[model samples]
Target: MQQLESLIRAAENEVSRQMQVCNACRYCETFCAVFPAMTRRLEFGAADAHYLANLCHNCGACLHACQYAPPHEFAVNVPQAMARVRRETYEAFAWPQPLGALYRRNGVTLALATAGGLALFLLLAIAMKGSLFHEPLAGNFYAIFPHSMLVWMFGAAFGWAVLALAIGAVRFWRGQSPGAVGSAAAVEATKNALALTYLDGGHGDGCNEEDDRFTLARRRFHHLTFYGFMLCFASTCVATLYHYALGLQAPYALTSLPVILGTVGGIGLLIGPAGLLWLNLRRDPMHGDAAQRPMDRAFIVLLFATSLTGLALLAWRDTGAMAALLAVHLGTVMALFLTLPYGKFAHAVYRSAALLKWSIERRQPNRLRIGGD
Candidate 1:
């Protein structure tokens, strides 16, 4: 309790201190939403720090643009500083606080859990079919796992993920105490989030990556990954309707809507995650918190594995490899869902809420009169 509060205070203090220096510099104010939001504050309180942390996209443009960056006496690394605070914010506000610890060691835990899940599913497959690889399972995955069992397994996991995320989002929102949001503000935030506007560094150009070179590659990859996930979710929903409502079952034809959507989405997931992992590896160390690499990589690897296994299953649905592939894919998906609330995925949820607040705040006046001309 007291210790937790102290930890939270320490994070807030760091964010506030760095942001004060950034406010004084004002060089990167136009780079992202965080700067403008920071300007609104004459001083950063805990709530202000929390809001600013979430508002930050961690785009790394400011770091490259900062004259006071590392080796300088000021040592102003906004991205890395904000990132550390943001991680602590997630844990401090995480619902069912005990699960917050998972965020600390998510990398190893994600890998082990994913592998364990795969083994569990494989054993189940063996028990059901008396073999690892069954003959020509086609797309009738329920044949191997049974429809009821599949529904129960995924239903519980997905439900838990949703509930946990919702609770966390609500808690964060309440902490910020963002007052009533108008329809216009809501629309604006939706547009910003959907377009990832901040990732562009508040200009028509792109963000700074390694060596101060601005590139749109990160934004493009993020879009691919986001829309890919959406399409996959849509495919699942359509398939579910086909199963229960339309009397259709697994083994839908390649040209079928669900299969086509999943195929396209799976391809996007593959390319997106692969590109992101490459960028992460080559990214400048000072830009963001180096400690977060493990958590970031965990998410990237899980997403890549899920998509890769899913595509493999689709490709080999008519062969003996389908059963093994299906189990592996299902395991990865399960692991992804299970870790959603406890991993980097929570950042999206928290950030989206912050964006919404920003939208509303924008509608109001700028009280700070910052960016002196």
Candidate 2:
């Protein structure tokens, strides 16, 4: 904890130092929320650094546009600096503190969680059904494991994830109160977040992405990934409604609402994560902290795997392979739910919290005035 504290403070200080330089020039105010938010305060403490870091989309436009960037003494790399602190912010506010360290070794954590999930379900299948392989159950998922049992397992994991994320976001919000949130501010923040307003380089010309080259490739992939996840969630919600409200059971038709939603969402997840992984691999080393790549890619891979297994389960549901496929699908989902709180998934919550702060703060007047020192 002490070492992590030191690292966090160091990252905060670097952001503060860079903001001091940026405060004078204001060259990139049009780049993103970070610079404009920076002008509202002369100094960035832990709270300020964290808020701005999450606000940064790491679009790399500001870094590429900065005259004082690397190769000069200033060495001002806002994207990289902010990236480091944003990662630390995840750790700093993580619930169960010790579990927060999982963020550092996210790839390994993800792999272990995935393996454990697969093993659990596979073993459970054998214990309950007396065999891993079985005849087609007619797409009856409840045959191997009862719905109630699955509910208890997934509900516990999902509930814990939600609780942890809520706690962490509250911790972050408490560290820096953004005063009052007006209706307009709330609406603005929602619009920005939903539309991913910052990925456009603070304009509509797209982002400088990995190589400081302007492109909307990242933005499109992000939309696919985020909305894809949302669609999948909606599918689950719809299925729950069917089961409880309508007393309907599983094995919905391919044209059913739940199946349709999941299928479309699964396709988006496939394309989105594949594209994101490609971009992550090709990104410039200086664009962000290389150390956090594991965390980023781990989350992407899990999402992709979840969708892949789900679609496969749907495809093979009527076959003798249905039971095995169902186990694998359930296992992937179990891992995804289990690690939601401690992994890259938390970034969405953090970034949304930060954006809400920015919207409220931006509603107020700027207090700082730039001067040549």
Candidate 3:
């Protein structure tokens, strides 16, 4: 515990130190939200560090632009510093204090979660019907695993993940304690987050990626990934409404709303994760803490798996293989949900919170700019 706390402190301190140099230089002030946000604080406290770190987006523009990065006495690498701090902040703010350490071993956690989920579902499928292979059921998945049972099981996992994320966000919000958000601030923050404004690299173009070059590849992929995930979620919600409200059961038509949403979303997930993984693999090692790459890739791989299994199930929903595919797909979904709170998924949550803070903070008076002593 002491060791973990020390690591967190060191990360925060490094960001604090880097921010001071950055504040003085202000060369990258327009680079992203992080710089302008940094100007709002003459000193980066724990709260300030946490806020700035998450807000950074690890875009790498500042690092590439920094004259002081590496080989310099100050050795300012803002993205890397911010990334180290962001990872620490996620662990620190993670709910279930004991589970916080999972962040350190996220890759292993993901693998275990995946393997465990697959085993559980596969075994459950066999136990349910006494055979891995089932008679043709025509895509009615409820035949394999009862709807109520899945609801209860997945609901618990999803609920826990949501609760953990909510708690963690609350803790982070309290840490920064950014004053009450006005309607304008909230709207602005939402817009920024939805559009990923910071990834713009201060120009309208895009942030730096593999080398000194700029690319919108990351931003585009991110959009596809999240939007795709949301579409899949929307499909689920619509399907649920159809089930209970409209008396419409599983095996909705190919042209139906639910299937369309899932299919489109699933495609987005496939393209987005594949692109993101490619970018991650090719990204400059110095762009962020290279150590966190495994965790990032793990999350990406999980997203890809989730989409792949889902699409496969959708494609073969009418065959005897539907049961088997459904089990694997559910297993993948379970893994994704189980790891949501403790893995790279937390990045989106924390970063959103930080963006909201920025939106609110930007509206308030800036003492540094006001006095100018």
**Candidate 3 RMSD computed on C-alpha atoms after optimal superposition onto the true structure:** 1.8
lDDT of 2 by residue, 93-189 (tens): 9998888898897784665577566857576856575777777888988887789998898899999999999999999999988898799988998
The models' CA-based lDDT, in order, is 0.84, 0.86, 0.87
* Backbone clash count for every predicted candidate, in the order shown: 0, 0, 0
Query: Clash number for model 3?
Result: 0
| Residue-wise C-alpha lDDT for candidate 1, range 171-200, written one tens digit per residue | 888988888989998999999999989988
Model 1 scores a C-alpha lDDT of 0.84
**What is the lDDT, from 0 to 100, of the residue 10 in candidate 2?**
96
Stretches of candidate 2 exceeding 4 Å from the true structure:
116-124, 369-373
The list of candidate 1 runs beyond 4 A from truth reads 1-3, 124-129, 370-373
In model 2, what are the clashing residue pairs, if there are any?
none
Question: Over the full model, what C-alpha lDDT does candidate 3 score relative to the true structure?
Answer: 0.87
TM-score of each: 0.95, 0.96, 0.96
Ranking of predictions according to TM-score: 3, 2, 1
Give the Cα-based TM-score of candidate 3 against the true structure.
0.96
Off by over 4 Å in 3: 116-124, 370-373
